[model samples]
Target: MIKFFRKIRQNLLSEGKTAKYFKYAMGEIILVVIGILIALQINNWNEEKKYQKQLHIKVHSILGDIREDALQIKALLKDLEKQHSAADHIIPIMESEQKAIVDSLKFILDFNSFTTTPILSQQNNTWDYLSANGILSELEDQELVNLLMNYYNYFDELTINFNNSANPVRLELRELKYELFTNTEHRKFFPTKKPSVPSKAVYESIFNDIRILPLCRYIGSTAAYFEGRFKDVDQKAEKIIYYLETNYQPI
Candidate 1:
C-alpha cells in the first residue's frame, strides 16, 4: 500500500501539473489520516471487549460463591433446629415433672455446648478491583454495585449476630461441666469407684435443678435466631442472582 501511494505521487510530479500535484498530495495525506483513525478505533474496541470478558468471569464467580454460601447456611440452620427440638423436649420434662429426669436435662444441656459453624467470610476482591480500579465507574450505571453491596452487608451482619447469640450457650455448657466433674460424681463414674443410682442421677439432680431448664430455653432461643438469619441469607442470595441475571452475562 505504501509503494502504491509512492508511485502515484511520483507520476503526478513527473507530469508537471503543479496545482494537480498539490491537490493529489493533500488527498493522500487525508487518506493516511483516515487510515490512522480507523486503526485507533479498532484498537479501542478490542480493549473494551477484553474488559467486558473479564467482568463476565468475575460476575460468574461471585454468583457461584453466593449459591454455595446459601446451601451452607441452610444446612447449618437445619442442624441448629434439631438441637433446638431436643432441648425443647427435655426442658418441659425437667420444669414440671420428676426431678430424676434432670439427668436427661444434663444431656440436653450438653447440646448447648455444640458450637455453631461460622458462615463464610466476606469475599470482596472482585468487587474491590472493579470499583477501585475504575472498572465500575466505567459501568453504564450504579445499580449493579448497589445490589452487590447490599447483599454483602447482609451476610456480614448475619455472621456477627449468629456468633454473638451462641456465646451464652457456651458459657452455660462450661459451667455445667465444672459442676459435674468437680464432685463425687466424677470418681463414681470413672476409673476407680463403682457407679450407683444416687451417684449417677440423684446427686446430679442438684446441679440440674440449679442449671438445666433455664439454660436449655436460652439455647433454644439462640438456635431459633440462627434459623431466622439463615432465611435472611437465602433471600439475599436470591436477590444477588436476580440482579446478575438481569444485568450481567456469564463467561
Candidate 2:
C-alpha cells in the first residue's frame, strides 16, 4: 500500500501538475491521519474490553468473599444463640433464693457455653485490594460502591468496639473462670479429654457466686447485640451478591 501511494505521488510530481500534486499530497496526508486515528480507536476499544473482563473477575471474587462472610456470620449467630441460651438458663437459677438443683454436668456445660466468645472472621481481602489500589472508584455501580464502603466501615467500627469494649469483658470472664472453677472442672467440657467430673460442691460454688450473674447478663446482652449486627451485615452482603450476580455478565 505504501509503494502504491509512492508511485502515485511520483506520477503526480512528474506530470508537471504542481497544483494537482499539492492537492494529492495533502489528501494523502489526511488519509494517513485518518488511518492513524482509526488504529488508535481500535486500540482503545481493545483496552476497554480487557478492562471490562478484569473488572468482571474482580466483582465475581468480591461476591465470593461476601458469600463466605455471610456463612461466617450465620455460624457466629448460631454460636451467639447458644451463648444467649446458656445465660438465660443460668441467670434465673442463680437469682432465685430456692435455687433449682440443676444437674452438675449441665451447669458446668452452661458455664462453659456463656463464657465462650465467637470471633467473626470477615472476608475482606478483595475489598482491601481494591481499596488499596484505588480501583474501588473504577466500579461503575455507584450504589454498590457506596454500599460496600458503608459495609466495610461498619465492620471496622465493630472491630474497634470489640477490641476496646468487649475484649476487657472477655478477659474478665476468663479471670472469673479461673477463680471460680478448678482445673478438673475446666477440663470437664473438653471433648478429647474425658476427665472425671468435678464434685457437686465445686459446681455449687460456681452456681452460688453472685458475681457470675451480672457477667452472664453482660454476655447475654452482648451476644444479642452482636447477633443483630451480624444479621444486618449478612443481609447487606447478600444484597450486594445478588446485585452483582444479576447485573454483571462474563466478558
Candidate 3:
C-alpha cells in the first residue's frame, strides 16, 4: 500500500501537478486517519463485549449463591421459630407444679432442644469474594447493592450476638442442667435410640432448678431476635431475587 501511494506521488511530481499532488496527499492522510479511527472503534466495541460477557458470568454465579443463601436463611428462620416455641413451652413449668411423667418427658425434651444450641446465620461466600475483588461495583442496581450490604451487615451483628449473647446463656443453662441432671439422665430421655420414659424425679429436678426459668426466657428472646433478623434478610433476598429475575439473564 505504501509503495502504491509513493508511486502515485512520484507520477504527480513528474507531471508537475503540484496542486493536484497536494490535494491527493491530503486525501490520503485523511483516509489513513479515518481507517485508524474505525479500527480503534472496533477494538473498543470488542472490549465492551468481552467485559459484558464477564459481568454476566459473575452475576449468574452470584445469583446461584444468593439463591442458596435464601434457602439457608429460610431454614434458619424456621428452626429459630421452633426453638422459640420450645422455650415457650418450658417457661411455664416451675417447681411449684407437680407434673406427670408424660409432661416431664416433654418438658425435658423441649428444654434440651431449646437451650442446647445457638442459631447459626446464613452464608454469603459469593458476595464476599465479589466484594473483595471490587466486582460488586459492576452490579448496575444500587438498591441491590445496598440491600446486600445491609443483609450481610445485619448477619455479622447477628453472628456476634449469637456467639456472645446467646451462646453464653446456653452454656450456663447446659452447665446447670448437667450439674442437676447427669449425662445418664439426659440420655434416658434424649436417647440416640428410642427415648426411655422419663421418671417424675427428672421432671422435678428440671422444674426445681431456679436457673431454668431465666434460661428459658433467654433462649426464647435470642431465638426471637434471630427470627426477626432472618425475616429482614428474607425480604432483602426476595427483592434481590426479583430484580435479578427481571433484569438479569443467567449464563
Using lDDT as the measure, the top candidate is: 2
**Superior by lDDT: candidate 1 or candidate 3:** 3
Q: Flag the better candidate by lDDT, 1 or 2.
A: 2
lDDT by residue (tens digit), candidate 3, 183-234: 7767786646666656656767766767777777878888888788778878
How would you encode candidate 2's per-residue C-alpha lDDT over 1-251 as one tens digit per residue?
99998888889888888898899899999999999999999999999999978988998888888889888778877977787787778777777777775575666676677656567677899999999999988888899899889888987787667657655676677788888777766676644355455777666777677777787778878877877876787788788878888887655
Worst 10 residues of 3 by lDDT: 93-102
Which runs of model 3 end up more than 4 angstroms from their true locations? Answer: 1-4, 95-102, 118-122, 191-193
User: With candidate 1 superimposed using the best TM-score fit, by how many Å does residue 206's alpha carbon deviate from the native?
Assistant: 7.9
Cα miss at 154, model 3 (Å)? Answer: 2.9
**TM, every model:** 0.73, 0.89, 0.85
Displacement of residue 141 (Cα, Å) in model 2 is: 1.4
What is each predicted model's overall lDDT from 0 to 1? 0.66, 0.78, 0.76
> Relative to the unseen true structure, what is the C-alpha lDDT of residue 72 in candidate 1, on a scale of 0 to 100?
74
The TM-score of candidate 2 is: 0.89
For model 2, the run of ten residues with the poorest summed lDDT: 188-197
Q: Model 1: clashing residue pairs?
A: none
